[model samples]
Target chain A: MTSTPMTARRIRNGLKIPLMLAPALGLVVVLFGGGILVGLGQSLGYFPAIGLNEFTFSNYTTVLTDRNFLISLWLTFRIAAVTTVLSSVLAIAFTLVLREKFAGSKITTFLFQVPLPVPHLVAASGIILLITQSGLIARIATAVGLMDTPADFPALVFDKGGVAIILTFLWKEVPFVGLVILAILQSVGPQYEEQARTLGANARQRFRHVLLPLIMPGVMSTSIIIFAFTFANYEIPLLLGVRFPSTLPVVAFREYQDPDLALRPQAMAISIVLAVVAILLLIAYRRLARSAVK
Target chain B: MTAVSLRHISRRFGDHVAVRDLNLDIESGEMVAFLGPSGCGKTTTLRMITGLIEPSSGDILFDGESVLSTPTERRGAVMVFQKHLLFPTMNVAQNVGFGLKMARVSREETAERVKEILELVDLPGLEDRKAHELSGGQQQRVALARALIVRPKVLLLDEPLANLDANLRITMRHLIRSIQKEMGITAIFVTHDQEEAVMLADRVALMFDGVLQQVGAPDEFFRTPRTTGVARFFRNGNFLRGHRRGSTIHTDVGPIEIVSTSETVEDGPSVLTVRPEEVRLVNEETDQENVVPAVVTSLIYMGSHTQLTVTIGDTPWQIQAPAAFQARNGDTVRLLLPRGHVSIVADDDTATTGSAEATLAEGSAVL
Candidate 1:
């Protein structure tokens, strides 16, 4: 006798597709949807377990009027913007130089990809150690008679300008952009470039007309992602950042670590603001991408 | 003495020789195809002609002036690639105007020329459509328009129809031939498809193993191929090992009559190549003098004609017959190998054994 019933068989076949998709759906809900809900509830100051159960706008107001909020936000935007622009230009140059066949192309490509696998914190520390006043650069300067002492090294690291932080981001981020754009460049297929040459486009014209537009999507998307990552990053800025108002993520971390439990919602509200900025940037990027494709 | 001439052209990629001591002269207003397999230096030859590649040692002259030293941009030659290379960001009109713009042509003239070229390509209103938005054939038309708008001295096409579907390819072949003929511009077409070369080119330059096997009219190359490689590349040709006795070459099929210019070498072992269409099928009892007995192993009906695989003395020869011909599998028939036009070349025992075995086992192999 068959142990499987007709109804059960029909039900099993009907549930097969949903069963296969269960893991992905569960991941989206638990990770993304759940995080958003938790952030929203905490931002509103309505968490019951911690005994703060009131509907108020104080968290948002505090986050907005905080002493370092505006400066940190501006600082973060400036650093991210500079890093994206500089890295995108450098990545495009690097890709063009390495696109053709040469003796060192493979080694150059390998070296560019090496930074991508390195942890961001590790890279940050490496940059700090190399560029700090008491670090190897200053030591070399002093030894080479360029400076009288290591303490006389210029105050680039941990300055109000955030030059050191931007440099650190560029050092680690440019290679990622290069690798992504390199793959895009390779997939573009050289037929178009050859046709352009035949159509009387010189090297510059070919780059502007054929190769650049084809690779623009990869460049823009990678640039936006890098901008968001550098802007929201906490550890690198916290370690190598100046004593004054740090980035938004650093400010949020300080609030989160404070002993007073009531300030946790304020930090969560700041995080929610950062998340909104990121989502807005993403939406703008998608719109730009659609326009470019058309 | 010619519109395009390559004298003793040679290209070496590191240690490997791509094209060695190649010499060719194409007349003005002639459409010639550099026909060969993938790596046989046909593309390298075209690239040299278009000034995209520099020959290792040679002088390439167009209209009695050396273009070998000229850069690609100043050579006054435009190339249409196998894949449509229309600018993705620009509409068809902008792409067609790109070359004129590069030459610093005025905006009014560029616009007028772009319109004229779009009309020439039969794509008048398609000027506003982006390259990707157009169909494959339409994109190819744009590519052609973009190249021809420059009004170059010559047009070089690198397998321009290789990317299209079968029907589109056939249609484009006729279109390109008509356009090339109409424009009276020196055209160089590169392709590995023999049929395409035969259909499009006024003269076909058959290349094999990085050397020019023969350069002649399509009928000459088809009827009197200078080498076994050329005959093999053309179609389903039956090649039989033979021995030369005076002016005749005796083979398994029969003795083939031939003429040779080189009389210094004594021919002991040779090969005879005959195309399938030259192989006639007659009644088994008809005792034609040049006929060989064979049995039909398979019959394939291909719209215009029927292709028969007939086995004769352990070797299967392809015989093309009319579509309405009465023929079926397992029918005994007598096959005739043409004696007068059959090609005979000295067989290099080492080189051909491998390629012949490989070519024999290719899709139409018979047991």
Candidate 2:
């Protein structure tokens, strides 16, 4: 009763990180948890603000079965997958080439990283201006006699294929992923490569067996972040997307802005589905990252 | 058995030359050590031999054939780096079998050879452990096994044991020497540690400032050094400034007759060097031919031997005697410099500085 129990309780209390993080964690739980709960309730058709207070799965059923929503979901998945794979491949290639300390390497590295600080919205606009029909390339092509008119140029932006969105994501994400991989490569250094060469490994063999395995974890983690970010991004897709089959976030926004207040639950339903997909992706990413470390 | 020959090899980075016009022939199955202090170009020479760095001029030949245009993987020479650069992602067995896999060896034979090499390095049953899970010494053994599994014709070791503790360093020195002998590979060991070089190599090549200072057997190096630099490097004895007159050299200390064995000794501005163990302490008032009267300045009691600093005509001289020899500070003693122990080295202009004198003082203090 003297001092032992007080000291013991204090030491035991020190082990609770959640208790220590109550201030910030509590705010996150309230804001994010409350927002997610509201969305789930609305997605389940329980929004009392519009006087619909019944707990039903009809909204989810409707959204899941819609042909337009299905197409939008497929487009989102395709864009995320293709963008993640292509950007990561290009990033790893650029990182390997720029790892060496050659003349003007400092300037070259600076140039490579220049796009990182730029906003995705700005990069999307830049891509549209350069490659969109009736944009800079079309004008230049017509002036060079390669095209008769701006309409003769191929459709690169505001198309169902999402080519401009993919290009914008690549422009922004490749350097970000490349910088991360470059950091890991620099930390591991050239010693292992040299050792592998001395052990009779050729150039390709060294890259495959030595450098690739060493940088896999960094590459995977960065790719996961890029995938999640691009999948959830609303700005790039909204700025350079067609009207027929839009990305999930764009469709969710359009439903939320509909004049019929009764359709708000449909917007929340789409939002909930997108969040679920992102969470599933996050779980998969964590599993892949843990295995890569091993 | 392959002899490695470096013919007039020189390496320069910009205006700074790392190794200058070095010509060395390493006999087949011989383990030669490149011994020098840091920044003395030993590692550069080793890397050049391993084909990691090409020479700025001249060429390297393996078994009398030029390997100048050969790639590093095809050079048939492997190097153990200073730091243990074991593959972090692979376990011990996988790391050791990497080179074998590169050569497309069968999995069964690779596993068998990996096990055999792990046992040879005394790291048996550790094949499943990752590099970070093992200790420094164990990681080094894995690196050694990895390099040796390739069956390279020449082995280049760059300060392989420098990261280990003193006891482990000694143990690994014997392990490397025995393994090299057992494999019968021509080896080049580059190290800044003189003791390690002398303990392991068949011959030690001492270097300084991009040049080979001396190369000989360990015992020959200690008994007879060719220059003042080598004498100072070995910390053999007191180097006193002297001038030759006939068979005797006149110095601050009394003139001691010397027998000139070097053809380059020409009777002007020579330095006399004698080992501390060679200087004999005799009874006072003895008038020997090469004996001089001195007073003991200090005595250091080492475990097996006692070191004495004695002064004769204001110049300090060091002498090593048995621990039982009794002498106190300020005691009068007679010292003899035998003609065989007194080596007259060519007086280099670089060795006559206050900093050099300070280094000699520090060296004698350690002795």
Name the candidate that leads on TM-score.
2
Residue by residue across B1-367, what tens digits does model 1's lDDT show? 1399889999999998899889988999999999999999999988888888899998999988898777887788899887777777788888889898878899999999989888887888777887789999988888898888898788999999988899988888887888788889899989999889998998999887678889999988777776666776777456666566777766666766665546554655666767888778777577556676777898888879888887876776787887877766887887766666566654434365777645543422231
Clashing pairs in 2: none
lDDT of candidate 2 over B225-252, digit per residue (tens):
8787787778765777655777887765
Q: Candidate 1: where is the Cα deviation over 4 Å?
A: A1-67, A260-269, A281-294, B106-108, B236-367
lDDT of 2 by residue, A71-161 (tens): 9999998899899999989999998879888998889989999999999989998998899887999999999999999889999899989
**Which residue runs does candidate 2 get wrong by more than 4 Å?**
A1-3, A6-12, A285-294, B245-247, B259-264, B312-315, B324-332, B350-367
User: Considering summed lDDT, which 10 consecutive residues are worst modelled in model 1 chain B?
Assistant: B358-367
For model 1, how does the per-residue alpha-carbon lDDT over A64-139 read when each residue is reduced to its tens digit?
8976788888888888889998999999998888888899888988887788878878888898899899999999
Give the Cα error of residue B248 in candidate 2, in Å.
3.7
